[model samples]
Target: MGSVDLIASLNARGPTSGFTDVPDNDESLPDDFQREKAKLFNPLKVGAFNLRHRIVHAALGRSRSAFATESPLAAEYFRQRTTPGSLVISQATSEIVRTSVLNIRKAAENEGRDQNHIKIIASSTTIVAATDEEAFKKRGEYLSYVD
Candidate 1:
């Protein structure tokens, strides 16, 4: 589904909690929210990259790597997040990130798109579990990151 449709489906189920800040009706979609979100989906040129969207995947300090080498999953992670005409800001400290980015570029080329088009980012995520116990457990785990 599209972003708006996906959001609508979630809103239909009622009480979205932390997932959304708005109520469930069309009237509740504030103009500012729509306008701001709409801008992100619009295209823009940043230096040499003509990005398809403003949505970026910024670098995070956290690494899933268990060793000095870039995990195979690292390339897969970028591949999953890759999109045409997007930008990615990787915080990978060394040349290891080069291999991961090249892997993503190769995947894009395989898909018949220009590999140079990608650049990436994230937004807030609320933990929603099947039960209150699971939710609190997740909350505690998330808090551990903060500490």
Candidate 2:
């Protein structure tokens, strides 16, 4: 599906969107994108350091265990996607402002990446665009993706 269709689908089934990215084939995304000629794989700076590609994942409703700890499955799920210079922003249970850090860190280390490269964030705040004009231009597109 196209990007707008995908977002609308997510909004429609937000609460029940259980790890929606699990592919039907259960196969890893091509690890060779950055090696290809596609412009999506071109390196560029996002917020700070340059990324190897333009792809960034915004995950929802993962780390589904109680607020105390993250499941190993969750770590493994993230580890598979943790290529160097890749960016993933995931949210845990909304009530869990923090959770066990070691499992995710260990998973990153096992993937041959520095654990510090991964960042875990939890919030109940609004995210604004770079400018009011930009925000107004795209109003309501990203609101209430999670119930």
- Number of the predicted model whose TM-score against the real structure is largest: 1
The RMSD of every model to the true structure, in order and in angstroms, is 14.2, 11.5
lDDT of 1 by residue, 1-147 (tens): 466664444334333222344445534444345644577667889988999767676543246566534566666655544556757776654355567778888999999989889873223468999999999999999988852
Q: Model 2: how far is 116 from its true place, Å? A: 22
Give the Cα error of residue 147 in candidate 1, in Å.
8.6
Clash pairs, candidate 2, are none
lDDT of 2 at 72: 75
Residue 4, model 1: lDDT of: 68
- What lDDT score is found at residue 65 in candidate 2? 52
Candidate 2 segments whose C-alpha is farther than 4 A from its true place: 1-37, 60-69, 92-147
lDDT of 2 by residue, 1-147 (tens): 544543334323323234455333333334553346656557889777778767675663253556546677677556655556767787655444444567778888999999999897545656478998888655656544433
**How does model 2 score by TM-score?**
0.38
After best superposition, candidate 2 residue 94: deviation in angstroms? 6.4
